[model samples]
Target: MSLRDRLFGRERRSAQTARKRLQLVLIHDRAGLSPGTLDALKDDLVAAISRHVDIDASGVHVTLRSDRDKQRLVADIPLAPSRERRRELG
Candidate 1:
């Protein structure tokens, strides 16, 4: 860490992360969904998607986004490469 970083408490990255989490909480509250409900929704999404395709469940991200007057549910699901694709890449 540089002297400037230490003096400025450059740990702002962690603070930003916390702020994002707080924003998510607010969004969920506004949308009338609890955190547990969100988790259950994510699990259901994983199960439904996994039935048809391979996915990296651990890396899946499901969140709510507020845009103008709309609250949108966004899901970023990472797909695992198929065996043929893996072999080709390897």
Candidate 2:
């Protein structure tokens, strides 16, 4: 390889590394949730839902989602459908 190509490659690597680090920091700042806290939250949410109905804990999905300027926590909690729900339109 040429000297110019090697220098360009180093620059690209540095840029990618910096972007990744920035994203990690920004995620924590925006959500105010540390890694440990998120884990505990997931556990608590699952327990709460399990108390009321039958759910597949393994299928539970929780994550932080962001709009252009707004951030929200989204959880998809799946529950078993009852026969009554199938018959009712209201």
* Clash counts for the predictions, in order: 0, 0
Alpha carbon lDDT of each predicted model: 0.91, 0.78
Model 1 regions lying over 4 Å from their true place: 1-22
lDDT of 2 at 11: 50
Locate the minimum summed-lDDT window of 10 residues in model 1.
6-15
lDDT of 2 by residue, 1-90 (tens): 568978777455667889987876677678998767877898899999889887778878777766788877878888766668857944
What tens-digit string does per-residue lDDT give for candidate 1 at 1-90? 678997998756677889998987889999998878989999999999999999999999988889988999899999998999999999
How close is every model to the real structure, measured as TM-score? 0.73, 0.61
Candidate 2 segments exceeding 4 Å error: 1-21, 80-90
Pairs in clash, predicted candidate 1:
none
Give the Cα error of residue 58 in candidate 1, in Å: 0.6
Error of 2 at 30 (Å): 1.8
Q: After superposition, how far is residue 29 of candidate 1 from its true place, in Å?
A: 1.9
Best by TM-score: 1
